[model samples]
Target: MKGWRAQPGRLAAIALLVALALFAIIKTDDVMRANALVAEEEAAMDGAAILASSLSSELDKFSLLPLALAEDPQVKALVAGDRDAARALDRRLETLASQSDAAAIYVMDAQGLTLAASNHALPTSFVNSNYAFRSYFREAMDKGSSTQFALGTVSRKPGLYIAARVGPSNAPSGVVAVKVEFDRTEENWRRATRGVYVTDREGVVLLTSEEAWRFHLTGSAPAAPRDPAEDLRQFGIAELPRLELPLAGASGEIVQVPLVEAQQAIGPAGWDIHLIVDPGPRVAAALATGRLVLVSIAVVVFAVIFALFAANRRRRAHEEAVVAQRTRTLREQLSQANRLATLGQISAGVNHEIGQPVSAIRVFAESGSKLVAAGETGQAAQNFSEIVSLADRIGAITSELRRFGRRQPGEKRIVAIGEIIDGALLLLRDRIHSHGRDIDLPEEDLRRVTVEAEHVRLEQVLVNLLQNALDATDFGGRIAIEIALLPDAVHLHVVDEGHGIPAASRDTLFHPFATSKDDGLGLGLVIAREIMRDLSGDLVFDANRQHTTFTMIIPRHR
Candidate 1:
């Protein structure tokens, strides 16, 4: 009756509907991701259990070897004042240690004293003191064969101790101990695990792989340069007692049981084998794929629903067009509102982005003007040249921003991509230093890529990428830009040793008004993408390597 009155309130209703739909879609996505993460953690825990079981089993074999040698009649006769037999036994032990992963092997007296060791060059005066109270010695006394772990005296390293008893009759007479370094233990465990670390009951790390060490040492104070001995002293075993670590997190209390609980005698007390499995990459990949599928379905459904709603709400084709126009206007108003809300932040970013080059130009102009007014011809010439240089820099900045923001079609010209990338680095040099970052350009060999694109716009894209990289990487971590020339296209890649963009956020990383950062307007990557597209190029995320890389590719003959 009211001539089908247009209600502006209906626009609010439509926005509310879109919001609810997006909330549902996002909620479902989060649930799926959570479930996937849980599953991955469970799998990793199960794998660790299997690895522990396998390591215990392998230790049994090593334990048996010492027992066999101790019980051998020839070995007993040799140790019983038979010099020739002792020499032969020492040779055998030496050969075993040299051939296998063992570091040292030796026979001890019935008193748990060191006797003939594996090598003749080894000091026999090194009596195995403080060992009678050792669990391995007790196990050899009772169980005939046992394995334990202790810090090495000579090497100042941690080693696994496998010991067994040798006797003339059935009664045990002496003990034999085989010392295997912790590296060997790690190597064995690495067969089924990513990283393995052996620590004392106090959580003091004993042995770990080089890769694992890198992560641990990252936050430590920088160590002074040293020789091998000093290096070992810093990282190796010490006489200082291990400090206890209190368990505070969800993992609960730390347990210091024997390697075997009841009677298996796998190893000694105060020793733990910790396995670290990096499930990040696998989980990220799986979650990304699943998210893609679910988002695709949701997007398709939402589009169909929106079309149906439009048709139902507006009967005529012209009416539908008017409704679409209204929607566009509403979107624009919303965007303007948001921008207004962030006026301060926008102002700050604009200043940060433009302040330096403008200051440089001002300085140059003032210097030149003062010199010319004084009629100092020589100084004026120098000042003028400087002013020209500064003006050129200001022009470059403007050109870059223009090309980034505008939708002008590209003019293709054969150019070296590396030169453009270096130019970008030059622009950001001050910023990089201010932020405590080091940006390393790729070697000439890696950067020589011939491509066709709008030169100034391409340089703008490169500057954007390198600056982004510097922000992402830590002070000591590397940021590398590489250029590769392919048969059909040229690729420019920016790699950073930083926490990568989350898999969940990758899709919207280049989208306008989409960002995880609190201070960002979300226009940088969007502008970068548009420029690349105008140049008939593409920007994409590449996760093939350990470092995260953003790759831009433009056709060679465009």
Candidate 2:
């Protein structure tokens, strides 16, 4: 204990070791949390894909069912109200329903009176009922074909209705309709460890694995014109609070079933099929991985501490005769070292700040050299002009570094998103042309879409996005840029035919120090996000589909 007190250096080293241990623990915990989130997002996307495929198959089986049934002779006769032929038509409809696995099949007259039905065997059958108020029957008679979802008046169960007109288009006799309940799909969801549902355009759950949630409206889905309590006898659903729906841009959306999950479009009824799974398993796996990482880091930290302690002990023996003068010198040297460290950090930041412009200069110079070799003197001269401009930019950056010190980069103006895109592509032109990569640019008229943003920061963000895309893509890969002039914002999308952003890294996508590359500082995206936010904008990623998509939204200036 006396020897330990004598060595202040060892104590300082031990403190550092403790700090490092705490840092490792905190970092690991953060990483595990991120990994768990990524796992959930991936699970949601996978579930949506599976649901979409299932729905596609299900729809393919019977998208044309009502059309074919509407053409049937017996169906036409049933719609014509032939009482004697109604029994034969009912038998024929029952066979079709059984064969197609449909919930029900019915023929309704022009006045919406049911003549025959597949479920005529059941007590609450539609054999001789009227459905004049149903939207499906009314829409089919008026538009030749229609699809809708509603609770059955007779069966009192929710189902989708696909209806097609019978007889001539000029003078249709009636409608042939099929009811689909997705019972098999719901049963499958219930058995599996996942939540699944289908919602109509009005955001009402027509079918769901959770029976209680069935026929309920999500906040986004449509609602009945009249309250359910007013017509309690019409449909058997109990009124419930609407669930929140968080939309995920154009391709998909997320539902908070107490957890985030994705939903995709399915069938002609404009139903969004959502799927989600238990997050427990993946979260546990991430925790286990983090524990292993922490253990490994702890071992290394302890080993480093041990080595430093042992060396300090050995040196203490060698300097047993040394005096307080060494301590004084040591303090002075430490102060100098701190100064140098500060300078080193500043130097690294300066390099990072200037790196993009330097790279662009090089790219332009090389392109110009090639043009000169090919006798394109006029173009080569234009490239030289860009070089001079970039040199002036470097000088300005250096001046700023010398005068104002380190600061964020952004100077907002009414800048065209197209100009930003053009600048970025101009920097990457040589690479794009050399690789013969296809680049889809927005229209020239699209340049009219103005966004108030810093020209440098916007170009920097775009360049970084494009460069990352180039790194991910192979030769001959395609890259597309699309611009949307939204009512409030100008949205820019940079799409790439690459493997996509990994699900594991999705949680920290825009966060600092999140990169797959060894040399990456992982600050490009982080800086880009800051720049956009500084200019009253946002940067988001959309990797829901096969490829990668980065969306940059900026406030539009008319």
Best by lDDT: 2
- Please list the C-alpha lDDT of all candidates, in the order they appear: 0.62, 0.75
Q: Which is the leading candidate under TM-score?
A: 2
lDDT score at residue 314, model 1, on the 0-100 scale:
62
Candidate 2 lDDT, 84-149, residue by residue in tens: 888888898899899999999888888888888999999979977888787777789888998877
Compared with the true structure, the alpha-carbon lDDT of candidate 1 equals 0.62
- Residue-level lDDT for 295 in candidate 2: 87
Model 1 worst lDDT window (10 residues): 257-266
Measured with C-alpha atoms, the lDDT of residue 85 in candidate 1 is 69
Clashing pairs in 1: none
Model 1 over residues 426-492: C-alpha lDDT tens digits? Answer: 4565566666777767677756656777776677666667766776777777887777777888787
